[model samples]
Target chain A: MQPLRLGLARGWVTWRSVNTTREGLANTIIWNALPLVFLLIFRNATIPGTDISVGVSLLPGMLAMLVVFSVMGTAYYLAAEREDGTLLRAKAVPRGTAAYVVGLLTVAVLDVAAAVAIVLVPGLFIVPGVPLGDAGMWLGLVGYILLGLMACVPLGVLIGSVVRSPRVIGGLGFFGITGLAAISGLFYPIAVLWDWVQWVVQILPLYWLGLGMRSVFLPAEAAALESGGTWNTPLTIGILAAWAVIGFVLGPVLLRRMARRESGAAVAERRRQALQRV
Target chain B: MATTPAGPAIRVGDLRMNYGRHEVLRGVDLEIRRGEVVALLGPNGAGKTTTIEILEGFRTRSAGEVEVLGEDPEHGDERWRAELGVVLQSWRDHATWRVRELLAHLGAYYAPYATASHPRPHPVDDLIATVGLTASANTRVGALSGGQRRRLDVAIGIVGRPSLLFLDEPTAGFDPHARREFHELVHRLVDDDATTVLLTTHDLAEAEILADRILILAGGRIVADGTADALARQVAGRAEVRWRIGEEKFVRPTDDATAFVRDLLTGPDGAGVVDLEVRRTSLEDTYLEMIRRHEHGDAAAAALEPAVAS
Candidate 1:
């Protein structure tokens, strides 16, 4: 309980610090706005055999991308903080690690929320035919975002713990997420890809997260164009929850193993290596 | 929490650590009493960091019996951890955090562990002043000078008001003025809380000035352990005797400086003796000789030199 409270405070402090900084603000704006630019470019285009604008169809996918972006963000922070000795600092205090995890998760969630808002608020005014009047749509949107974070944050921690270098995580993680997005049908229908690729993407959380977001934002008529010719709400919920469970189960084990190996000498050796690289 | 445990603050017996085939600590043994300031002096790559890490439960030893505050560090819990303070060599962690902000956040973790006799967490403002960072209390850690940053590290270490503190090369990169201030801060801390400290350093003068007892680690073992004066005397009980007779100057190394000086003063040239001086072997010389003999594969000879002279 105490660790949780402290972690929340730590998370708030860190989030505020990052958001208030010019670099942090610039990063948030640029990344979130990139998807918005795509939406605007296709604003006048309509879906094949439908009256809905392409921009409206792409908004849910953009929201899903924001959630997916959090996965890489979480991994980047974990690896960077570990390299910088912040993780070891947490280990020094009583229950500090617990607080650190809570704080990290808090920041990750807040980042997703901020990114989602940046795209969604302006998106609401620009993209037509979003069922904003329906309360259930709003609830479902919030639910999917929360579920997406739960599924992704733990996977990020697992990746961060396994990878020793932040540069590697940042570089590889960006390409990896971009590739996943390509296959997960964030910008187009999965039916257009090969059957095996569709099968592979279905096993991952991003695909389900994007499916859940589409269900909430797209009109019922859009379901006709989805894979299997309908929205599989149960499958989307089940797959995302399963991914969340797998991540929660495996994340801590790897994180603890990585943490157990941390010491002052290790940190020093890493610093020496980092300096040599520079 | 009120009733402090009774016994040595730290006890290690036959502590051995090996990295594959390379043995770092072959067989190390030492004990530190409560409230005693002990310095672990060793050369680079002498397993100083390894030994400290094992004691701090950050590393596992291959073989040893180790107890820190009456519990094996290998299995020490959070309660055990709260009783210990570790001052790490900082490398840009928490840089965005303000001095006061970081201290208060870290200190809050100890709140539940506080006791009537030994309060957990020294006050934030007071701790800032203690480390001479009061003016920079609100300043970002990244903005601090090297010396100021080191002071903040110390402040963070003791913020939890730990009963036992581990300082690993606490003043490594400090300039002279910063070093002096750091030493004074340590003195005040010890005077105020009687906190048992175990610090590792290559600085012999620092060990002499700051430590109640000094342990010289060479060749993976404690080659010498005693007060600075005792260790110096153990190394051959030798001293340099210098004097001037008219235009001639004389210098001689002898095991018995007092007797040699007395005899010289009362001898034939006693009336002419001027600028008389006797200088005992400095800790630096003793440390170098110990390291040299050990490096030459004369461990027995080096280990015996101190006892034989004593």
Candidate 2:
């Protein structure tokens, strides 16, 4: 219980430190605004053979993209912190690792929320046919975001623990998430891709998250454009929940293994290698 | 809490560590009592860091019976961790965090472990002042100078008011002024909290000033263990006595400097003797001699023994 309280305090302090800085603010605005600019450019363009504008369809996909990016960002931070000795610092204290994990999770959630809101607020006014007054739409939005975080945060931890280099996550990870997005149908429909590609994408969390978002944001008529030609709410829920359960179970084991290997010698050797690269 | 465990703060017997075929620690043994400031001095790759890491429970030894604060470090729990403070060499962790903010956050973890006799955390502002970072209390850690950063590291290490502290090369990169202040800080921690410190350093002078006892580790074993004076005596067991008779100078090494000086003075040249001086072997000289003997596979290395007076 004490560790939890301290963790909460740690989370708030870390979040405030990153968000309040000038460089942090600038970074947030630039990355989040890219998706918005794309949405605006396609505001008037309608989906093929449908009365729905591409902008409205792209909004939900953009939100899904933000969710996926949150996972990658979280993973990157974990790896970076390990390299910089922050994780070891936590280990040095009593229950400090628990606090450190809680702090990181808090930051990830807050980051996703802020990024989503930045695009959503302006998106509401710019796009058309969104059910602004529908309580169901709002509830679904909140539910999907919560589920998405639960599913993705653990995966982030697992990846961060497994990967030795933060640069690998920062460099290759960006392209990997972007590539996953391309196939997951965030920008276009998944049905248009090859059958095997669609099957592979369906197994991953990104496609399910995008589907969940589109089901709530787009009108009921828009379901025809989906791969199954209908909104399979149960399948979406089951797939995302499966990911969440799997990640929660495996994440801690890998994290503990990685942490057990951490010592001053390891950190110093890493620092020496990092400096050599520079 | 009143009935604290009655034993040495740390005890290790026949500690051995091997990285595959490479043996780092081979049959190392030492003991540190409560409130004792012991310094581990060794050349690079003598398994100093490995030995400390094993004691801190950060690494596992291949074979040994090790105890820290009465429990085997291999199985020490969070309560055990709360009682220990580790001051690692910092590179760039918590860089964005302010000095005061980081300290306060870390100190909160110890609140539950606080006892009547030993308070959990030293106060944030007071800790800041103790490490001489009060001016940069609110400053970002990344913005601090090298010396200031190390000061913050020490502040963070002791923030929990630990009973036992581990400092691995605490003043490695420090300048003279910073080193002096750091030595003073260690003294204050020991005097105020009775914190038993186990620090590893290559700086012999530092070991001499801060350590209640010094242990010189060479060839994976404690070649010498005792006070600085005792270790120096083990290596040479003689002091140099010098005197000038007119324009001529005389130098002699003897087991009893007092007797040698007395004999010289009472002899024919007693009245003529000028600029008389006596110098015992410095710890640096003793350390170098021990290391050299050990490297050359000399049997005398084992003869140095503990030399610690009971």
Candidate 3:
């Protein structure tokens, strides 16, 4: 319980630092710029069978994208921490890693919240009738966002634990998530892709996250644009919950293994390798 | 016997560490009493860092019986770890945190471990003042200068008010003034809190000034162990004695300088004696000679017969 409380404090401190820092705030804005512009440019463009503008339909997908970015952010931070002596410091404290993990998760949640607010605030003006007045709409939005985070953040930590360097997260991690987004129907409809590709994308959490987001914002008829011509709410919840459960199980083990190997010598070796690279 | 229930703060028996086929530490054994400040002095690659890490439970050893705070370090639980303070060589890790904020955050971890007699974490302001970082309390960690940063590292290590502290080259990059300040802070910890300290350094003067006992590690073993003065005496028993009889100077090296001086002063020529001087070997000389001897095939001989401080 004490570890948990301290972890929350750590998270709160880190969140404030990240958001208040000029570079950190600028980085978040710059990352969302491309997607925001993409939606604005295609605002008048309709989604073929529907009268809704492409901009409004893309908002839910952008929310999904926002959550996915948190995963990348968590992984990048972990890699950077490993390179520095931050992780080893955590290892030295009693139950420090447990608190560190909790702190990291807290940071991820707040980060995702900030990302959503950045998009959603401007989104309300550009996109019409976002169902803001409806209680059900708010529930869907909150539920999907929570479930989506639960699904992605742990997997990101798992990847971060295995991968040695931040460069890998940038090169392999960024490209890999972007590729999933491309097929998961975030920017475009999945029906346009090959059936097998759609199946592969659906196996991932991003697709269901995007779908869940669309269920909350898009009108009832928007379900027609989905692959099965329905919300598939049960499957979305099931799959996302399954990912969360699996992540909760595997994430700790992998993180522990990664942390157990961290020592002062290891950090020095990494620092040496980093210097040579430069 | 009214001794403290807690056993020796640290004890190692036949500690050996190997990486692949290369052996780093070979059959090292030592014990440190509570509140004692011991300096592990050795050249680079002498396994000072390795020995400290194994005790901190950060690395696994090939073979050894190591106990810290009365528990085997390899299996020490979280409660056991709460009693240890470790100061590691740090790069820029918490670059964005404010000095006071970071200390407070770390201090929270020890809140639950607090006992009536021993409060777990030191108050943030007091710790900052103790380490001479009170002026930089609000500054971002990244903005701190190198000396200030090292001081912060020390502050963080002691935030928990650990009973046993491990410092591996804590003042590696410190200037002379900062080094002196650091030494003072360590004395304060030992004097006020009764914290046991095991530090490693290449600075012989530091060992001489800070350690109650100094252990010279080489060839994967402790070649010499004792107080700084004892080490010097053990390594080189002879002291140079110089005297002048009626402007004619004479010098001789003798194992017993007192007897030699007494005889000379009382002898027939004693009346003319002047400018008498006896110089014992410095720790610097003793350390070098010990390392030189160990490097010159005497390591195996020393390893077979370990030196335990009496």
Candidate 4:
């Protein structure tokens, strides 16, 4: 709960940075407008399960994917800011680092919240026969979303601490998270993979996030037809929590150490080395 | 926590900093009083910026005692940081933020600023005006010119109303007019607020314009420390008085040019000086001499001795 509260604070600060003025507001509108793109292209595609509309079938997965992408982007932006000294300057402020980190990760919180709102509302109202009304299922959805977002914070800090190039942030960020997600079954089922790949992905959290979302949103009949006919709810929650725990416990320590070691001079030296290499 | 004001505004004694085996700063001693604008003048890799960053609590010293605003900068906290301001060379781009609005947000971070009189959050307005950014106050940082951006950097640095400011090559990309204007603002800021300034610059003219005292660092040591004019005299030695007398141009060292001119010109008839120009040593000439002397020792002395005597 404390971790959630801290994450909430981070989310709120990112919101504040974005909403501080009209430009920020516009940026959010542009970012949140992503669902509109989904509506235009894949909104009418054939359903994945049963005879359900593709818009309805892909909605949950799209929501989960958007949340993951937004969360990862927030994490990477923070890493970039830290690399560029903005994070260090924020650390020098009164509350020290925890507050500042939460502030940067705040963007992801807004992203995930907007994504969840946009995903659920449309699936609930516009799409016919989209599942709802199971209290346990709703609980599962909230749990995974919250847990998934929590995991992003530490990963964001880790990526920020390790990646030094401001320009490479996008490449490193997309490749790292998307590559991990590809095997984890966030966008598609792991059952489509080779036996060796399935075994490998079973060890990842996104597989559980995707699995957890499917178990909650899909009709129980559809869920029952695949993957042992039961949601790995406990396993999904536990793995996500573990990632969050590792992120929380180690993230700050790593960030502080990285900040202490890195400086403007370090960046200049790295640039010199890069030039020499070239 | 103790606020008796006993220690200097900035102090670094025997400070040594290194990256790997390459020592950047070695045995550097520095002291800056409150309200004093001390300039660190040196060539690139001369450890000027390193010393300033260490004092600003942005960099850790490998060895030495550094007390900034009566606190150990290496172990400084938020309160210590609040007492000082730093103008970094550049800023990151935020696509949507206007300049004034951005400064206002940064000002809100300080504890003192959470008040009533600055109700609308116009703290940075005067600083914006101070740095000559009134026209660009509404401009986004992304849209600003290099000189304008640097000015905004200065405005942001001083927005906290800090008692001490660390400026690392503040006027680097500024034009001549902008640079001169910045110096005036600096002088006024120092006078009005007693804001202790520690500036690092490659430009000697900028140092001479803004610094009350200058420290020339080389090989991570303070090779010369004095007021700009004083440093020039101390390093490059006496002025040379040259006069065109008849066919030959005669050059002689003079401690008192007024008295020397009377003896050289009026003492003898037809030995009257035609083209007499008294030249004093410049900060640039002295700085080069000091840095060269620090590196080459006696070899430097041999070259500079005859040049100074003439």
Question: Which has the greatest DockQ?
Answer: 2
Off by over 4 Å in 1: B1-4, B240-253, B257-279, B307-310
> Which of the two candidates, 2 or 3, achieves a greater lDDT against the reference?
2
TM-score-best of 1 and 3 = 1
Per residue, candidate 2 scores C-alpha lDDT tens digits across B1-310 of 3225688899999999999999888888999999999999988988899999999999989998999998888888898999889988655888788889999999988888898977878899999998888899999988999889998888888999888899999999999999999999999989988889999999999999999999988888888889987787674456788889899988887877888888998998799999999987778877876677667765244434433111
- Candidate 3, true inter-chain contacts retained: 0.65
Residue A56 lDDT in model 1?
85
lDDT of each residue in B117-142, candidate 4, tens digit only: 32322357787887788898877666
lDDT of 2 by residue, A1-278 (tens): 88778878887888788777889888887888788898788888999888898998999888988887877888988998999999999999989999898888888898898899999999988888888999999999999999999999889998999998999998888898889998998888888889999989999999999999999998899998888798899999999999999888998899999999899899999999999999
Model 4 chain B weakest 10-residue run by lDDT: B113-122
Tens-place lDDT digits, model 1, residues B1-310: 4224788999999999999999899889999999999999988988899999999999989998999999898899999999889987655788777888899999999999987977878999999988999899888887899999888888888999888999999999999999999999999999999899999988999999999999988888888999998887675578888999989999998888889988998899899999999987888888988888778877667766654432
State TM-scores per candidate. Answer: 0.94, 0.93, 0.90, 0.84
Clashes of 3: 0
Ordering by TM-score? 1, 2, 3, 4
Give per-residue CA lDDT, model 1, range A1-278, as digits (tens).
99999999998887877776788789888988788788778878988888988888889888887898787888888988887888888989999999999999999998998899889988888788889899999999999998999899999999888988888888988898888888888778999899999999989888888888988988898888888888899989998999899889999999999999999888888888888999
lDDT of 3 by residue, A1-278 (tens): 87788788888898887667888778777776667777678767888867877887889998998898777878888888889888888888889988888888898888889889888888878777578899999998998999999998998798889888988787777788887887899877899989899889989889999999998998899898888899999999999999999888998899988898788988988998988999
lDDT for each residue of candidate 4 in A1-278, tens digit (9 for 90 to 100): 33334435545644664576677567556665565566556555655546645555555665566556654566567655654556555544444355566656666666678767865775566555555777876787787788878876576677667766655776765686668766766555567789888877776566777777777777666665445667767877788788788888887787788877655566555546556867
Specify the poorest-scoring 10-residue window by lDDT in model 1 chain B: B301-310
Q: In order, what lDDT does every prediction score?
A: 0.88, 0.87, 0.86, 0.69
Residue range B1-310, candidate 3, lDDT tens digits: 1123468999899999999999999899999999999999998888998999999999999998998888888888888888889898656787888999998988888878898988878989999999998889999898898989988998888999988899989889889999999899888888998889999999998988899999989989998889987877664456778999886889997877899999999999999999999987677867776677677768876544432111
Model 4 whole-model lDDT (C-alpha atoms): 0.69
Full-model lDDT, candidate 1? 0.88
